[model samples]
Target: MVFLDEPTTGLDPDARQEFWKLVSSLKQQGCSVLLTTHYMDEAQRLCDRLLLLLQGQVIDQGTPEELIERTVGDEVVEIAGIDELQLQGLTRQADTWYRPFGDGYVVALPTQRSLLWEQLGSLQPQRLTRRRANLEDVFLHLTGKVLQ
Candidate 1:
């Protein structure tokens, strides 16, 4: 068994890739590897399961995809340049999850994009992007959004 704590923390991207390859090789050789990393991409790439920790407590545990789907849902929409009033209005809508991010908000939903479009699209945001949910989304959802 091997335990690696932020093993690739300071490595360049290319070096990180190489390190991950080595970790993959270890998995192939049937070695148990316990890895801890703040980099969600690394965890998603290499781990078959993940343990989500916050404030020194285990908040959730599952396959990365399972975790993401369970917590943040299927899709996330990012809208830039929204005001606090708009945020409050959006929050009051039925069945939605949202969080404020830099100069914008990240909204998640399992369905009802058209409904959201009807409500928020009229605002004509500076930038609006829709993407599939990811581990970071799950982390932020399960844990508090406030920076520690």
Candidate 2:
């Protein structure tokens, strides 16, 4: 077994790639790896299973995809320059969940909702985009929008 905690934190990209290759080789040789990191990309890439911690407590644990799907729903819509209060009534009517993000808010839209599109269009946010959810979404969903 091998233990690494933020092992690639200060490595340049090339060195990080090299480190990952070395770890992959070790795994192929039947070595088990235990690692701790704040880098979501690293966790998603290297871990078969992951535990998410907030405030020194385990918040969720699962394969990355499972965590994302279970916590963040299917789709994310990011809209900037919109007030949370302004969207509250619409969001309630539309079947979407909204949380403040950097300079704006991200609304988690369920894939099954066809009416949400029309509701969003009516609001005409300064910017809006649809995307699939990932680990960051899961983190924000489970831990909330607050930085602390």
CA lDDT scores, all candidates in order: 0.80, 0.81
lDDT of each residue in 1-148, candidate 1, tens digit only: 9999999988999999999999999999999999999998889889999999988999999999889878877888888876757755675573666787667778775464447755667778887888888887787777866311
Q: Give a tens-digit lDDT track for model 2, residues 1-148.
A: 9999999999999999999888888889999999898888788888889999999999999999899888777888888866566667667766567788787787777667567756776677788888888888788778885321
TM-score of each: 0.89, 0.84
Off by more than 4 A, model 1: 112-114, 145-148
Structure candidate 2, residue pairs in collision:
none
What's the C-alpha lDDT at position 71 in model 2?
76
Model 2 off-target regions past 4 Å?
145-148
* RMSD, every candidate, angstroms: 2.7, 2.8
Clashes of each: 0, 0
